[model samples]
Each structure stands twice: as structure tokens, then as C-alpha cells.
Target: MTVGPTSSTWTIQTRPPWFFRRVVTNAAAGGSVYLADLVTPRGMTVVVEPAKISFSTVAFNLIVEVDLSGVGRVDDVGIKSDYIGNHGYLSWVELNGTHVVRSPIVLFIASPRT
Candidate 1:
């Protein structure tokens, strides 16, 4: 599945416990769960890996590792993403590496069956 960011402000919601498990499962299986190809406003596309993913009472935090050193971190912190049927949503996000802190949205659409 594909994921990025969407808008500046996000309305967070609680998700079923199974949701995180599914995401982790997919990632553990060497899938594309954390393959967030975040495109910056400057037209630079960077791939990120989820360093720490955890869901709490009100929202969740996704701390990702960026490939470029000193580029800063990509934090979709205190946000929510959902997986419904074959589609997924990366609703709220923030990239703090740069001073601008652009919000890049990500969509997780399942790949076609081979």
C-alpha cells in the first residue's frame, strides 16, 4: 500500500487494535507498509521508514527515518491513518526536517492482483 500526507490539520479518531497489528504484520512481511514516498514542496521526493509506530488513547505517532542525513525527521506524529477493505488513508502528517514543515498526504491503495 502507498502512504504520504494530506492536509495541514487532521481530525484524529480511535482505531481498532487490529488495525495496528495489520500494519505491523504487513511491514514485518517485508511489504510496503512503511514505504511512504513523501514529496516535498521543493520537488524532492524522499522515502521513509517507520522507526517508531504506536497508537495511544487519542491518536497515534509515526516517527520515520529519513535517508538524507541532517535532513531532519519525518514525523506524522499524533495523527491517524486508516485501512478499509483494499484502501488505506494517511490522513494527518507533518515533515519537520525543513523549516517550512509541509504537510504531504499519502494514500495506500492496494496493488492489483498478479
Candidate 2:
């Protein structure tokens, strides 16, 4: 389904506070990583970018990981790479812990549909 900028609801999931902290830390350190949701099969694609104020070459990957405990099945997951430039990477995994699925998370990061 195509999402508009003003859409109130988003399939995008959110992770717990602690886990989010860890993700932030990792991104700040310029680590190329993936954000996974424990509840849902689909998750956000993350890419870390260096901040202008930093001298250590640290980048921030601001991908939000959703919590899917109360949800049901995940049909499909995808992203648009151009949304956040060339650094974004989106992915997902099955809840059964048997399969790893990767897709573009940001759809037209440069031009999100309004």
C-alpha cells in the first residue's frame, strides 16, 4: 500500500526504549546495521550518516524499529533507497526465526508522496 505523508497510521513499527537506545548508539558510531522488530516480520531499513559537527567520522542511522507483539502476520515489506540518500538499507526477518528478508525501507525518501 502506498503511504501519504499526512497518513495518521503507518505500518512502521516501534521498538522498546532500551533497544532504541542501543540502536541510537550504534548509529552514532557509524555502524552499518539493521533494525529488527520482535513482533512483526517487517522492519525498518536503517542507514547511518555522519554529522557535520563530529570529527571522529561518526554517523547517525535513524531507523525506527517497530514492536509487533500484538500484531498478526506480515504480508510484505519494502523500502525506497533514494529517500535518505545512498546510505539507507532496510530489512526484515520472520518471527519464527528461520528466515531473513531484506528490502528497501524508505520509498522515495527524496520525494515522499503527499
Candidate 3:
């Protein structure tokens, strides 16, 4: 795990059983995406339920879907539109319904630390 959105906040880093490692704060009358750094693995016991993000520069195509439900296990969710004039083209990412295979899409993990 390695979500991004630094400078204002929005960072998630995990490796093992997906413990806890969070930091997201992009203000602008917008907030709610927290999960401090806990990195579990010693005894393994994590429970973080926090996810709420609404960001869109207005150009279409900025999909973020995070529903960890509990525990840990999120593989291959994609979205990457280099900085330029984005034309939009990332049309799939289903986590609990199958169809998952796309990488390089930064920003958007709403919640996943349980």
C-alpha cells in the first residue's frame, strides 16, 4: 500500500498484514480521512474505520473507491493521468465484484486500515 497526496495530506503506507499508517488532510472546507501511523505486526490487531474524500478539479474522471470493510487485502486498483491536460481514460476498478488490474493512480483510498 502506498497512496499519495502529500503537501496538504493524504498518505497511506502499509506492507505486512496491513496494520496502520495514515495521514490525510487536504483542507478547503474538506476533511475526514484519518488513520495515524501504527504499522502493526507484533501481535496483529488493527481496526481503523475512516474514509471520506471529495476532490475534483473539474475535468471529469477521478474515481476513488475504498471499502476495506475490515482486515486487509487490496491489490491492483488503477488510475494515473499524468500532469498535462488529462483526456480521461481509466474506466475500471471493482474490488468486491472482481475485475481488478490497473496500477499507477495516485490519490484516493478513502479508508483501509483494519
lDDT of 1 at 97: 23
lDDT of each: 0.27, 0.28, 0.28
Q: Give the alpha carbon lDDT tens digit for every residue of 3-107 in model 3.
A: 333222224343333333333223223222222222322212443433323333222222244322221323323322331111111122222233322222232
TM-score to true structure, per model: 0.21, 0.19, 0.19
Which of the two, 1 or 2, has more lDDT?
2
Candidate 2 per-residue C-alpha lDDT over 12-111 given as tens digits, one digit per residue, 9 for 90 to 100 = 3333211211132221333233324222223333332211111132454233432222112122234444343222322333233343433332322233
TM-score of 3: 0.19
- The list of candidate 3 runs beyond 4 A from truth reads 1-16, 30-48, 53-114
User: What is the Å distance of residue 62 in model 2 from its true position?
Assistant: 24
Which of candidates 1 and 3 is the stronger one according to lDDT? 3
How well does candidate 1 score on lDDT at residue 90? 29
Q: How close is candidate 2 to the true structure, as a TM-score?
A: 0.19
